[model samples]
Target: MGPSRIIAVRHGESEANLAYRRAGERPLVYGRGDDEVTLTALGREQAAALGRLLAALPAGEEPEQVWCSPYRRALDTWEGARAAWGAGPLPLTVDDRLRDQEQGAFARLNPAAVRERFPGEPARREAEGAYAFRPPGGESLADVVVRLRAFVRHLERRADGRRVLIVAHDSVVLGLRHVIAGAPDAELAAVLEFAPVLNASVSVWRTGEGAFELVRFNDVGHLTS
Candidate 1:
């Protein structure tokens, strides 16, 4: 069986994201609706930069699968990068499963306030990584992994020896990296020590034998002038 590669790219910044406010609530506004957000000026530029990188890849190596979070930001990222891969008129597949893990009652709150109000919850989430803590009415990090794993498994089976691109949020992106790296539950503790991935940065992974391994981690060289 041929090895399959996946390029996981985080979406450009969103207003809530930049503000460190919650995002999973209030409905996703960028990708699916007629009444949604347009990219911020900086976000547009980031998308263009990501597009150029996609354009520079080898011929026939263009991404064959384009999956994105249902969020508007992720949708716009994929849309902006579409032409770079000669994918005009290609529909971007929206995956709710790829949405950021829900923030629960904290969805629209300031991060600091959430910490202060739900002190213990934040501590648990921080200590456990995305898997151990669940916000009220939201999911735990373990919940996210299950959905992400299903998506990854589906992609592996459908790769048909082609590259895949996914545009999503920071939590999802980071969680994927950990999952693919084969880090156990005990290892989530140290995973966040690495430099944070920037907007539009890309990561690469290959899957085999029910496992995934990292080929590249947070490559943003293309974003530099």
Candidate 2:
């Protein structure tokens, strides 16, 4: 049996997110690696909001276990949420597999920079589509799916019948959707193009008769309310 419920949350907005937003067409370079980027002030507030929302859940629906990415932003977000929850500690594990999709040489480069740097990558990415396009030395969405599949199997083995919470990146959320729904490449690509996941958003899945069903996707009502 799998987990009775799975709640996945994307990390709060990070310095990188803000940098990219403000960079416009210029090449935005990070002084630190992606894993080291911390959340912005607003991101911390968003995380605290998530914590409060979780604390308000019915007793039966509360999370039993927590899995989080090891990245700094994710760790900080979890810390912020946990502090706001003010509840007894839940078992928390930092898993490298939950880390964001690796962008390789294209890590912080905008499309224009990527085009200027690699020259051929844009055309190649376009040709391969979102699912199959592996950045210079990075993993493709398909690669992310491979690792996430392993993680899901691990969850089934370790967290059966429990409520589990996962704090991870947008790519991990997307990968989980693909893995759980058994979605095709085209469908996943469509989602990538049309429905980008938001910072600190919550997605939920429930299991019944050994099948996982999506209850919500990219829900940020908690942040607004």
Candidate 3:
């Protein structure tokens, strides 16, 4: 049986975001790898806010199963959010499938810097088409969708109508959306262009009529405060 509900949340603002904002004129040197990036102070608050929001949900809607990315930022969010969720066993499990997409040469380069440092990448990415384009050693957007699809299948098998929550990265959010949207591989690349992933936002999906339907995308009402 499929999960009754699935909530995908992006990790809150991270140190990378802060550094980017601070690097006004300088070429923001690579600070840390994607997996190593940690959430900022406000990010911790955002995670706590999410926890309260979830706690306020109807009991049945409260997440009974939590799937989180193994990355530090995502894990930190879960650690903070789970506190407001409940007192007993958290039922939280980390899955590598939900981790951020691997980055090769693009590991920590700013977008603008990418063109200056890796001149061939842009043309090659454009030539191959965004969906199928893989960086020097990283996976493509389509690759992420494939792994997310596998995670969905795993969810179908394990969720069994339970309310489920997924805390992960921006790419994972888009990846999950691409998988659920059931778009053709050709269209997968445009998913990000059309659906912007929001940090600390919750995207809710429900499955009942033999397919998943997105009931809400990027809901961040809790962060208003």
Candidate 4:
């Protein structure tokens, strides 16, 4: 009766996740020779667990369609969940809009490296909720929100009465949260300050009249059990 419910799920933990470096900051090497840098064993477990959680949802609340980022890590997560929902044959659209924000020179760097490279301004911005601070050749939190706004608007208009599952990255998840919460740009940055979106966490949204409400945020109901 309204815009379809959006269940935004983050991709499983990645190799960079365990490596103490943020993959988004690293160069684009996936689909070339980056399989080893995909998901970690724990990430695989987390994805399977998420699948079970999704499978357990009531049929009425289950997703009727699925969308995923083109990244191999995201696709790997979706594949891990295939069995839990019996979500066979349903086309999973790949939307680059859902890709993670580029981390610039910080992609494969640790905190120390980030600090060394960026110095006072970078650290200060990271600490003080600087959503608009764009790094060299990368995106800022504000940039991510802008992209997510378009995606949400499209979904709000194109979908109705069904649940849509979005398998995406942390930047997308964080942006979606800010969009649904109607947070001011300043506040949105505060929310992400050092709080990385965990693997396979879910954020739920309901939209109407060009607006959205965050029904749930960072929901790890599957992991609690």
Candidate 5:
């Protein structure tokens, strides 16, 4: 039987998020590689708190199987929260496809720096926009949807009665919305114009008679508590 409930949780805030906050969208002189980045002190707390919340979820929502990004931050969030939640021996699988959108040439840089260093890129981005124009050497949002399409199918095939948790980065989490629920680009962009998926936030979906439906998006009430 395939899994019935699907949950996607963004990894807790990282040094990367802190760096972006400190720099305010400007390039940081230093930043960790995706695999090297770790959760901040608060991030660790958030992850643990998330675990406790999960432990207290209604039986229907508790995770039965887990998959996480191979990146350090995502891996740590899943392990820390699960251990803290007191859930015993749930199976976890690390999937590289769950990794964050690869940063490539801008791996550790921000938007302004990309413009200053590669003046042409800004114009290219303005012309092609977020959905199409990939950062140099990086994957586009469209590219992410392609792979996520395959991954979602893989999930449906194995989900029978399982409540699965996906611990991953923001892009991976958002990409799943498009693949799993067919969120329209305009709808997603409009929502993103006002809000971002916070660290350790949870989004949920479940199979229906016809297709998967979004149960919630970016639910972070657990973190506030």
Candidate 6:
């Protein structure tokens, strides 16, 4: 029996997100480690807005346990949300498995940079497809699913019948969708193309009739509202 409800959140926009956006025609290079990236001002606001939404949930629906990634951006996002929550701290656990997808040798390199650095990688990735394409020393989306599968099993064991909140990265959110929905590998590409996970988006899953159903996917109503 897994948790009755699971609320999965992607960390708000980070400096890296901004850099990637501004890297038009150039290779975007992040100065620090991925785990060290921090949230932008707008990201903080988005997180606070998310917090307000979570805080407003009915008592019975409120999260009982919180899980987060150890990455700085994720932690900071949670802090901002918790402040806006104003309901005092919840039981929080930081887990590395919730961290973003590792790019390995391709870390901090944009498409152009990757091509320039490793001329053959782009062709290789194209051949392998996005889901199965594993970067050198990094993880593929399939690899992410492997770890997320274990995490979901752990959640089911420890959080049976409870409502839980998870604050993590975009990859984690997508991975959770794949794991919880029991979707096939072929469907992931469609989901990626049709349903891009936005930063600070909220996704909810609820258990019903012995199975988990998606209540929402990539919801940004809190920010828009």
Top candidate, metric TM-score: 6
Model 2 lDDT tens row, 1-225: 878999999999998888888877886665778899999999999999999999999988989999999999999999999999998889998988999999999987766678778998888988998788999889998888889989999998999899999999999998988888877755767557525889999999998666888899999999989
Per-residue lDDT of candidate 1, residues 91-166 (tens digit): 3678888987776776656656676567787677777565477888877766787788787767656665767888
Global Cα lDDT for candidate 6 = 0.89
What's the CA error at residue 191 for candidate 3, in Å? 1.4
- Sorted on TM-score, best first, the list reads 6, 2, 3, 5, 4, 1
Answer with 5 or 6, whichever has the higher lDDT.
6
Count of clashing residue pairs in every prediction: 5, 0, 0, 2, 5, 0
Off by over 4 Å in 6: 185-188
**Each candidate's TM vs. the true structure?**
0.80, 0.95, 0.92, 0.82, 0.91, 0.96
Candidate 2 — which pairs collide?
none
Candidate 5 has its poorest 10 consecutive residues by lDDT at 186-195
Question: Can you write out model 5's per-residue Cα lDDT over 75-143, one digit (the tens) per residue?
Answer: 999888987898889888888889888767877777767777788887887897666768889998777
Any runs in candidate 3 off by more than 4 Å, and if so which? Answer: none
Candidate 4's error at 209, in angstroms? Answer: 9.7
Alpha-carbon local distance difference test for all models: 0.71, 0.89, 0.84, 0.74, 0.81, 0.89
lDDT at position 88, candidate 6: 71
Per-residue alpha-carbon lDDT of candidate 3 for residues 1-225, written as tens digits (9 for 90 to 100): 678899999998889878877776566666788888899999999999998898888867888889999889999998888886654666787999998877677878776677778888889888988768888899887888888999989988988888899999888998888888777776776776745677799999988578889998888888996
TM accuracy, model 2: 0.95
